[model samples]
Target: MPSLYSAPVYWNEQQYLLSFYDPFTFRLTISLYIAGISLIPSACSAPGCISNYYPDDRVHIFRVPENPPELKQAWIRALHCDNIDRLKVVNVCIKHFREEDVEYIHKVPNGDGTFTSVPRYKLKLKGGAIPCLLPGCPSYYSSTSTSKRARLSYEPKEKEMLNQTIQLLSKI
Candidate 1:
């Protein structure tokens, strides 16, 4: 009978060395790198918004609130995105909200009876805040009025009453 072992193995062709290398560590490292990059949350979640997160910029990004299903749904509707999963993790930039909706100061109650207004370093959305100003979206989507509508004409009796009031005021 012939000996059982006889053939010469080619290391390069067979990748004998690579077999010893653990791919799990390499794959884990790559996965970790990608996760780290995604942790920054640099982009806005609002549809058609071009705003990005910058440390030095005045533009502030607010996380989408998960609680209050109605509020969250309103935000989703305003953003024009139906992806609830994506909205759960994404943020909306300040540009999407009205100026009044962005709370620059917070009223903190002191130990005494007085309430102090503390200026916030980080911008926050007021309660029930919803994005209304979407400049990047179509005119129909934005809450901003594109054109001024003409005032309704007063009725004859109303105009006569107004004239009488004006005349009475002029006499006084």
Candidate 2:
């Protein structure tokens, strides 16, 4: 017995069927599927930012907050993104935030009214934090300084006051 479907016949039939569709569109669709390109968008939302979400990358992506209108506006302005009245599903990467704004430890409360500071494996934004270190943007967008300032000591003032008090007591 002979096979009903032959290879030449099958290929000819496929080519004939494909001729009805636009070649560019069909080839593009097939190539995209074969290339395994993701349909989901996973890039940082900041303007000019090229960071993308990857499992192995140390960079962390954070969702833009929708609540607290002030914070949302601040993030939008700092990022230099416009016309984003609704920031749903928008993500900002860790590169846009200052070192102090990102929290790396979690304070777990103990039953005995004490707290233990446990290091966190994932990064989190501190409360009232804003994204101010936008790279590839105007320098004014990152107006805040990154350098930590040295704290002035009050020990000299305290020592002078103590000496004055001691002298007063001795005279009395």
Instruction: Kindly list the per-residue Cα lDDT of model 1 for residues 8-66, writing each as its tens digit.
Output: 33445423211122243332111111322443335687777756533233357888777
- Model-by-model lDDT, in order? 0.61, 0.62
What would the TM-score be for candidate 1 when compared with the true structure? 0.54
Point out where model 1 deviates above 4 Å: 1-41, 53-58, 83-88, 144-172
TM-score each candidate.
Answer: 0.54, 0.54
Cα deviation at 158, candidate 1, in Å, is 35
lDDT of 2 by residue, 78-152 (tens): 677776556456888888887888898899999999999999887799765777777778887775753311111
Stretches of model 2 off by over 4 angstroms after superposition: 1-41, 53-58, 85-88, 145-172
Colliding residue pairs in candidate 2: none
Model 2 Cα displacement at 99 (Å)? Answer: 1.0
Total backbone collisions for each predicted model? 0, 0
